[model samples]
Target: MKNTIYVLLLAFLTIPNLTAQDFSDIDKSPMDVTIIRNQNHSPMARVIYSRPSKNDRDIFGNLVPYGKVWRTGANEATEITIYNDMSISGQKIPAGTYSLYTIPNKTEWTIILNKNINIWGTASNYDSEKDLIRIKAPARTAAATIEDFSMAFQPIDNGANLLMGWDDTYVEIPFKNAE
Candidate 1:
């Protein structure tokens, strides 16, 4: 009877430790944040966010619609906080964290940088006049479907090309940052 009790106790004690051991490697995983500066010739800037394309049925059309405020990407709004005032489409945007949104259309997409940042995706709190900058860019059909929505800033001669893509469509917005 004592031997059986001892074995049972040993099994119970070892199980928890083994489970912990399995997750011990998780702490060693690489962190997902990368801070880049002076990138693509734009000074005084930072990009704190990016997200993958959502494959759900309600993503492009049901979730994000035509001539509506989209949270830019999945999850939280694809936020970009700049440390200094910047120029977007010849409009001045002060340094701060702004909620990025878009109104997608067939021929052109309007990118809106709203002053509100803590709200949910496409919340009604968005004000049109409060927008710091509004830029229009043409959209093109892609040969493939982008399973995940993605955004990247590519450096050009005097400015950065903000690229957004998903589900066989891509758009680019160019802005020259103030020096």
Candidate 2:
């Protein structure tokens, strides 16, 4: 009985050290991201985003390939909000929150704006008819891999560019601010 107790205690003490070693090699890690729109302005929109780290892998043509549908982020589909009626990629969209998706190819990426806001990682629950807008954007390659996924809005003259990227893949969608 004493021997068994000693063995158990030894095992417990060693397990955590082993686990620490497993993660010690990683210098950086991924974290859930919070993105806010018009943070300094009134009536802003907020979104939460996250994705796995690059982990030294090539993102384009590897982790995420051409001619595939991506959830737009990690766990849940990337989300967005329109505080008021806005024009996206030349199409007008109403004010509300929506889930975003993308169909990627070599030349372009088709952005999908779905009405469903609450979902988990695509969830296989997408309804085609609920989609509010679809737009095409040119795909671009980055010189370096983005260790973690990122989404941000860059204010343009009359609109904003919704930028999404992880690793070497990136796509931008232009949306006009409500008038």
Of candidate 2, the 10-residue stretch with the lowest lDDT total is: 27-36
Across 1-179, the per-residue lDDT of candidate 2 in tens digits comes to 99999999999987766544465655343335444355456544445666677778866667776667677767777777677677876788888898887877777898998898778776486676889888899988867777787877777776677787777778887777666
Candidate 1 on 1-179: residue-level lDDT in tens? 99999999999987766544455654221212222346544455554444554555545556577778777765455566766666877788787877778888877888888777766555665667768778888888867877767666677665567777887678987656676
lDDT, candidate 1, residue 161? 74
Pairs that collide in candidate 1 are 53-148, 53-149, 142-168, 146-167
Q: Can you tell me which runs of candidate 2 are displaced by over 4 Å?
A: 1-40, 43-45
What is the TM-score (0 to 1) of candidate 2? 0.74
